[model samples]
Target: MSTQPPRLPPPAPEDAAARNMRLLVLLRWLAVGGQLATILIVHYGLDIRLPIAPMIVVLAALVMLNVMTWLGHPHWPVTNFQLFGTLACDVVALSVQLYLSGGASNPFVSLYLLQVVMGAVLLHAWSSWALVGLTSLALGLVAWLSPPLALPPWFATTLSPVYVIGLWCNFVLAAVLLVLFVTRIAANLRSRDAHLAAMRQRAAEEDHIVRMGLLASGAAHELGTPLSSISVLLGDWKGEAAIRADPRLAAEVDEMQAEVMRCKTIVSGILFAAGEVTGEAPERTTLRRFLGGIVAAWPGQVTFEDRLGEDRGIVADRALAQALTNLFDNAAEAGASAILLTAKLEETMLVLTVADDGSGFPAAVLAALGRPYNTSKDRRGAGLGLFLATNVLRTLGGTVQARNRPEGGAETILRLPLVSLALEGSR
Candidate 1:
């Protein structure tokens, strides 16, 4: 479906260096085999008198070039040196072969095109053009200066056309290989840049996690006293006889107490997670119940919807409830009154998405959303909320990705592997 050539695998630093070595060794053997077979077939079947000894010595030079190709990557200085050396050898070999086989009249003279093509494949554009010029001049010199050998009567008059054809082949092959290598180099640069960006994104996420933990721990400590006082006041108010007489007051008090308890529970959970201060905590919980609590606890008025597919779920530190609460709060602040949460299941894996019809991502927080220092909220948030969530998901062999929708709003998708699901349920 693509017009471009199939790319070689990404050459990341590592075993790739050794792989280059092995490849050069293999290429040397292949080139040697092809040359040896050609020489044997031409000598015996066609009786072409070539400079066999000089050709054998040139083959030795090719072997040395192979060793250097193994040591030098595409951009190394030694790579160009080997490329030039190989081109020189190719020209010398072609000249020697021409002198023996009747100069331009030789049946095999057209094959010199391969040398120029090989040079272009491995060299930069400027170097490739220089090599092409050298090739053409070499062939012309051989045709004019070399003494003509006595050939069979059938091929006597075709000498001029033969040399012209050889020159044309050399130039055409050079053009083709130049295009090939240039395209390969461009693709390599793009892939390397993408890999670098991913690494930087990860490092920023880690720094965010540490800062978020400290902030959550501090927030829990500060809220402890007020939550305790409210709990006692509500109990005393419930005991008053006037409150029992008024059903309306009793109901309102019950709702207020429920909300206050919810806030206390959320604060306590954050401390237990970030501060490691809980007595008993579950390692994992069912996705449905976990998410339902998150939506119910959000501080803003919003319609929340969910659709869990068959076998759809996730395994996390049960701390996922707090993580989702953080995300929901962000959506609420973005003026999203409605949000949708859904999960997809296919072949033992889960993909959960949280979507909101609010401004996709604030321009201010875009650059540092998952990082440790840039909080979307105007307050000093320390920006670790999403960072913590991503880590929790990663520990369970999952990932989190966020993207702004082309139409409007934003979505966060979490991909989870299910290999350890049964193991998680036990916790």
Candidate 2:
């Protein structure tokens, strides 16, 4: 994650969707390939005709499907019903082989357990247990009611009842239990996968929105220069007032000037937050000295306090200092004469916290805090502060969250990937 982009242009939404789909496809195929290789070794290398041949074929076909999907071939993935369909075909195949080989006493008669487990993994709870029931019934009926064929070249003349009972206990009961727990594991996997997909989607969408805001901010900045020039000319003309003293005209003109100035300020803030204009990277600043430097630079009236971890540190990008400064300024604006800051290392993550005893986020701005066009800063361009902070952190493989403290103040928590801390430590 530390190796992650210091900045990223949010990827297109379509890429996110495709990426999730591909992950599932890859996982499915990997499972199929492993299973098939196991089968090939069992059948060819060992000459054991354990009646797993049909399942081996199934695994092989699944591998092919996975490969095709990965190679840009699109088809619905193997859903529960498809898994069931494959098993149903296998059941028919095995049933015929059972009749030809040795009926219920055949060692391979236990392979129905495989189908039961597979079904359990993909189906809902009720459906999974139902599949288990159906499998038991089918295998039981085949053993009980169906006629037994002659034993194979290596099997018994006739099957003993004890042998059949033992087979049932070993294969059937174990299969049932296997399906039960495997279903649980698979269900958890499905839920976890869903959660991961949702998280990625959120990150992707957030990235996209931020990129759009950046573009809009850039445009606003470009527009600001001309708007400011026009505003200055309007102010100069307003002094003359085309023969002096139309109260309505003067008020309207003043409103226009204010609006123009607002646009200009907003654009300037955008440029600043974007790091569009920056001085050379200052002599490499470590997390501790850099932040200390920031506090040192704060105005005398405000107490800019900071603490850093012994192990965790940041390289302190030239622009990153400004980003951190913006956060401190926000604290100052909140009427805080003093700000408390602390940095800590937790394993591979660096957490930076900033808190102001001053008033928490104002009620009006609380709802839209990180949104690009909103800011509590009364000045026009102040909205870009949080956005700039967010983008900087994001680019650094980190996160920033703003929340009002339950007791009284606002807190902004910044988390950076531990990779940066690791890099700093190694140095």
Please write out the lDDT profile of model 2 over residues 1-427, one tens digit for every residue: 3676588788744533344445556656555666566556655675545457556565566666656656762444444554455456545555655554456865567667766765665555776677777766667667776565433366436667786667666666776788778877877888999999978866875886568668866796668778968987887869984625887878888878777775564565456555565233435446667667766655434343444446334454544565677788887777876677777666667777887777887665657555575665567666766776777787778888888888777888888885653444464
Residue 35 of model 2 has an lDDT of 51
Q: Candidate 1 lDDT, tens digit per residue, 314-337?
A: 444446666666667666666775
Q: Report each candidate's C-alpha RMSD, comma-separated, in the order given.
A: 13.9, 14.2
Evaluate model 1: give its TM-score. Answer: 0.51
lDDT of 2: 0.65
Roughly what TM-score does model 2 have, to 2 decimal places?
0.43
User: Which regions of candidate 2 are displaced past 4 Å?
Assistant: 1-119, 122-159, 173-192, 195-203, 206-210, 213-217, 223-303, 309-339, 344-350, 357-391, 401-406, 417-427
Alpha carbon lDDT of each predicted model:
0.66, 0.65
Root mean square deviation (Cα) for candidate 2: 14.2
State the lDDT at 119 in candidate 2: 62
